[model samples]
Target: MAKVSFDGTSGFEVPRHVAIIMDGNGRWAAARGLPRGEGHRRGVEALRRTVRAAGEIGIGILTIFAFSSENWSRPQSEIRDLLGLLRLFIRKDLSELNRNNVRVRVIGDRETLSDDVRGLLEEAEELTRNNSGMTLVVAFNYGARQEIARAAQRIAEAVVSRGLSPADISADKLSEFMDAPDLPDPDLIIRTSGEQRLSNFLLWQSAYSELVFMPTFWPDFDRTTLEQAISEYARRERRFGGLAAAGT
Candidate 1:
């Protein structure tokens, strides 16, 4: 689809939270006759550009699926490269993000992360903790199933400690146990590379999210593609399991 511009339009509304499944770096590199590592490096660059574009367009919350828990099973060298890229992003872009009032957060388990990566994550989160601007949430070593399991554990603990009954547990209350309980659920999820499956990104939060899947690869995804996705999102009549305008 061709890119669409905001063009000072009044009817278009920006979603409160936008989550993305960034995929197809390897395939993109293969098609271009480039190394896989090169593809990842370029993907990181695209991520930076996308972040800037989102901030420029007033995106409130951008949750990017960076490294999943399943990613750890990849070649150790590739994982090392990804970690190096992450550390580089923090060290190099922390100042830029702070200047733009972009708060950075990693919503994944840190126990498996190397000490250096863990330290960098803490530093980035703490540094941007005071920022009130757009929240950039990165899912590294994150699994939707694991998150739900952890939430279940917390809910059980609450039931025991606060004298709450199991029958009283609700979906809304269960959400409080997940990471970033205060953050609003994702309103839209854009998956590049035309993938239709969620791939364990955000199981609980995307119940009503409008998904925009495009054929473009993750590294090829830029501001223009983002605008197109936003336009499609605006045009869709999201009824949240109900009827749309024609039905009404």
Candidate 2:
């Protein structure tokens, strides 16, 4: 990934990879006495703005928690609306994303999705596969625990069938089996709607990521909110489980 300081902001190193848990769409809609579907529509706009913002700022990768595996339990109407919005996003925005030189990558359970939805996800990735700009990873129907378990299952299978030793499976090797292994680990993670928990977004990948909780809803998020999150990220010291550097 290219190293570009964020507009020469002194004392701040821009994160190479930033992940966001885009929460509170339903809540935002309810507070306004509107249907949850409207909130989701607006969230798509937010995602568009965020992608452009990340690219303009030279961030290498931006991963978003769009939908979790547990979200399947929501109301059937809401699920339909959510899936509809996803389809609309791909059909409407795929060209723009490609024109902007952004690469789209989907990381989640592809097998569980319906045929049409799966096709759309694959289309988004295939259309923008060779873009040179920032990579946008959407974690739809993704759960960290499930992802880790799947990786472990793969490792076990490899050991048994491929003559690979179990002891050779280090953390780095294990991550190769996880989703989006080619993407770098998140340097900073931001969750909106004042949520402090990860909610099973990126458990294994965000092991040492700096976290920021924002009070803004997903529909209201813009480049300013993203910059604020990055600014907050800039204020921290990442020790990666070690002691702080000298001179504080």
Candidate 3:
């Protein structure tokens, strides 16, 4: 509920939590006559930049759509490349992230992942569990619809085991069952590559988030791109289904 201010003459009101759908990797690679894997590699570099920029700009939480459940439907070779990149990123950047006090939180179905992959994710969280700086949420193998269904299943199990009445279920109760209920909902959701839709990222958590679509590809995203999105978010009024303020 607290507001973050940009320390500049722009007087931008930065969002406390920002979620990004990193898209256009393949297109970027294609445009450059390079393999898609190369684009993904560059995308990772952009991620490193964005993370540093977010921390420097006073962002409390940064959630990224790293890999989605539907991404498995892509070519097996591409899937392998993505998983490899994830492994490389964690192995190479985990130490630096911890030293900088960045907390890593992963949300998704871990049961389906290989033991090694799962272990790495667990290690990332454990190593940074006590960090006090910005929290980075990686949505790997995640889908909002599946997350909601999983929460519903847990609620049902609790009702059966604890003899709780079904009437006690509410929106807030359902939210508490989500993967990372302690994390606040996103205040702004940005999709790069000119995408206009969420594409299954943070459906429930983005109910009132300001959406910004950028023509820039994921590999081209930088601090300026992030600032542009934040500036646009500041220019708008979030009514949340109510009337705007009396003054303009």
Candidate 4:
């Protein structure tokens, strides 16, 4: 595909919900003869650009796959570095998020995170909770299978507790226990570094998402890549198991 410049004239409508799997940081660093941590350090610039682009483009909900549960299997030092980077990112980016009217939200088992990092996460979320702007969801230490399992547990507990019955469980009801129940399913999912698989990201929510895979590494992905992905999404036919034209 060729690069295109969308000066607001393109037939591109901002997706109501978009999710990203930021990949290839370590590979990018290795290719550049730099340490993996240095790659992650540069990747934050891409995160900033993508979030700001989401806001600029009017995307209502944006979810980023920051750290997965499997990521903990990496070398302990690397994991520590990632956590340190996250803490620093939260502290430095909160003000920028406030300036842009973006609200930060985290989806995952946050209890496992360090106390200091958790505090910063909570404070950032609280400060921007009321902002009527784009919602930025960071999935740290997250796994979709675990999320669904947790949702199922919640439903079972409710059924056993008092008024709910096992037969009352439904898809919508099951989704209530998800990390953020208010946000809609992702309309588009972009995976950088040319990955085609989901890697268990938003298994239930992304059932109907249009996927865009880019060869550019996460650290190299820029505003142009964002536009390209959006344009590709615009070209997709999201049937959702129905007539394509019938879809809004």
Q: Return the TM-score for each candidate structure.
A: 0.94, 0.95, 0.96, 0.94
Model 2 alpha-carbon drift over 4 Å, by segment: 1-11
TM-score computed on alpha carbons, candidate 2: 0.95
RMSD of 1: 2.8
Per-residue lDDT tens digits of candidate 1, residues 1-248? 12325766555677878999999998999999998888898999999999999988788999999899999889988888888888888899999999999998889888888898889989999999999999999898999999999899889999989998999889988998998898988988999998889999898998989999999999999999998899889888889888877898
Tens digit of lDDT per residue, candidate 4, span 1-248? 22334874635567888899999999999998999999999899899888887777778888999999899999999998899889889889899898888888989888788898778788989999898888899898899999998888788888888669778778888988888998889999999998899998999998889999999999998878988899888888878788767555
Worst 10 residues of 1 by lDDT: 1-10
Q: How close is candidate 1 to the true structure, as a TM-score?
A: 0.94
Give one digit per residue, the lDDT tens place, for model 3 in 1-248: 33455455635557899999999999999999999999999999999999999998889999999999999999999999999999999999999999999999999999899999999999999999999999999999999999999999999999999886889999999998999999999999999998799988889998999999999999999998998899888888999888889844
lDDT of 2 at 38: 93
Residue 225's C-alpha lDDT in candidate 1? 93
Report clash pairs, candidate 1. none
Query: TM-score: which is higher, 2 or 4?
Result: 2
Ranking by lDDT: 3, 2, 1, 4
For model 4, the superposed segments whose C-alpha errors exceed 4 Å read: 1-10, 246-248
Model 4, position 58: C-alpha lDDT score: 74
Residue pairs whose backbone atoms clash in candidate 2? none
Error of model 2, residue 216, in angstroms:
0.5
Task: Report lDDT (CA) for all predictions.
Answer: 0.89, 0.90, 0.93, 0.87
Candidate 2 residue-wise lDDT, 79-194, digit = tens: 99999989998899899989999899999888899999999999999999889988899998899999999999988999989998877989999999998888889999999998
